[model samples]
Target: MTEPTRLGGFLRKSGAFLVVGGAAFVVDAVAFNLLAFGIDGHGPLYDMPLVAKVIAIVVATVVTYVGNRYWTFGTRALQRKFSRYVIFVALNIAAIGIQLGCLAFSRYVLGFEGILADNIAGTFIGQALATAFRFVTYDRWVFPDDHESSARTAIESA
Candidate 1:
């Protein structure tokens, strides 16, 4: 492919990844808020922010795995890629650790607490860093497509 064609293909695939990631982000944010704050009373089990972050991350990981497998990466052979998917899940757990560490640092070390601090630490800072890690890993490890040129071809022809 030409340089321009390759660039366009990369952008198109990136756009797809962003769309899937954005949807998962919404799910994570909403679930985190509900779990951390509750509706009209104290939140459910584990009022702690880290616990809430864990729950939110679990929920969002499911959404992200499914979206990334089917939509973003287009890996339809679940049986074949099950082990790779597990590795992907493991990486996400590490990403959650990064997020939780940020939240903990802000809340404990920095002596800041509550919703805003948690959001700033976990959502913006941690997630941004984790996102770069995820994109690289998802491309290089999890979705190891043998016919990667097919995806590029479709995008380039569009």
Candidate 2:
């Protein structure tokens, strides 16, 4: 592929990641809301929003992994990619910690105890920063489309 074509492909992949991430975010947010505030009354995790967030993240991450592997990164080598997937999950957990930290700080330390503050600290600002970090790290480390590796594989088989 030409350089411009390669760039275009990368941009398209990035856009797809953003779309998938948005969907996953919705999943995370909905699950959190439901867990923290049940339909009829307060849920089991009502007082423990951080724990609820963890559960929500795990659910959303399963959705995200499938979307990223099949749609965004387009890796068909499932067996080989499994290790990378594990690493990605680990990194994602760390990213979730960032959001949790922000919420904890705002809610506990700063004494900004409100749903609006929680959303602002954990969902909006934290997610934005974590997304930026994830995009770059995922492209480079988690799911690199390594031309060198492909070339080497072909050479070895030949």
Candidate 3:
């Protein structure tokens, strides 16, 4: 591809990624709010914040993984890749820890009104770092190796 064409392709792919990422963020936020606070039909899981958060994060991660694999990276579903995805998610858990830890520290230690602000702040930071890690791993390791220009090429070689 020409320089301009390659740049355009990159930008097009990037736009799709932004859309998928935005949707994933919405999924995470909505799930967290509903599950942790018991908003929207869920019961007030006030005492079980940890459990609620875990569940919510898992749900959000599923959506993100599916979107990224299918749409962003244009990869088909593969069982082996799912195993790699698990490890990817394990790393994401660290980011989740950072997010909730920030929320707890800011709300309890710093005595903020609510951690919504700090939680959002922390999550933003964590997501950026974690997503970069995810992208690198997904590209270099998770998805199948494609020595050829097309997946068909790799498949035929295999």
Candidate 4:
């Protein structure tokens, strides 16, 4: 029956974020693999891994948006639906860039063209970086706390 400390709240929120992100990651990975490297090592978009990644990210973005909106940051003040979705998509585009950069570096720069390498570079490393970016940006901008929400409201009304 005690108030949760700030750190405790953050930890709980982070846990929920991780769960949502994990589900999104699974969707992204499965889609990317299926499109880029099928069961027989030749997927539909096998020749174009970047395109495959973009498509996968798009699908996973939908999952993340829904999960984060209703589960991860459910208690946060709601913003205008259109505006929130636009901002969410913009931030996701940036995160996709992070993922793409890692994948591109592994595929083009490092001359890595294997499933394992792609997963390590794009799925693991890139996701880690992008997840950190998303957590901060989502908390601060996409789903602001009460104070920030009020300030945003003032700015919108001005």
TM-score of 3: 0.67
Between prediction 1 and prediction 4, the one with superior lDDT is 4
Stretches of candidate 2 off by over 4 Å are 75-82, 146-148, 152-158
In order, the Cα lDDT scores of the candidates are 0.78, 0.79, 0.61, 0.88
Each prediction's RMSD over C-alphas, in Å, is 5.3, 3.1, 4.8, 3.5
Q: What local lDDT score does residue 38 receive in model 1, on the 0 to 100 scale?
A: 73
Error of 2 at 104 (Å): 1.1
User: Best by lDDT, which number?
Assistant: 4
Task: State the lDDT of candidate 3 residue by residue for 23-123, as single tens digits.
Answer: 77677766766765555444475555555556666777777777877887674344554577667666667756755665566556776533364335434
Model 1 TM-score relative to the real fold = 0.83
Candidate 4 at residue 54, lDDT? 92
TM-score to true structure, per model = 0.83, 0.83, 0.67, 0.88
Kindly report which residue stretches of model 3 are placed more than 4 angstroms away from their true locations once superposed: 40-43, 75-83, 113-115, 122-125, 148-158
Q: What is the lDDT, from 0 to 100, of the residue 63 in candidate 1?
A: 81
How many clashing pairs in candidate 4?
0
Question: Please, what are the lDDT tens digits per residue for candidate 2 over residues 1-158?
Answer: 69999899889888988988898888887887788767754767878978987888788878777888789888423336667867897889888988788878887899875556766887777777777777888777787766656777999999
Q: Looking at model 4, report the run of 10 residues with the lowest lDDT sum.
A: 1-10
Tens-digit lDDT string for candidate 4 (15-66):
9999999998999999999998999988999889989999998898888788
Q: Model 3's lDDT to the true fold? A: 0.61
Candidate 1 vs candidate 2: the lDDT winner is 2
Regions more than 4 Å wrong, model 1 = 75-79, 148-158
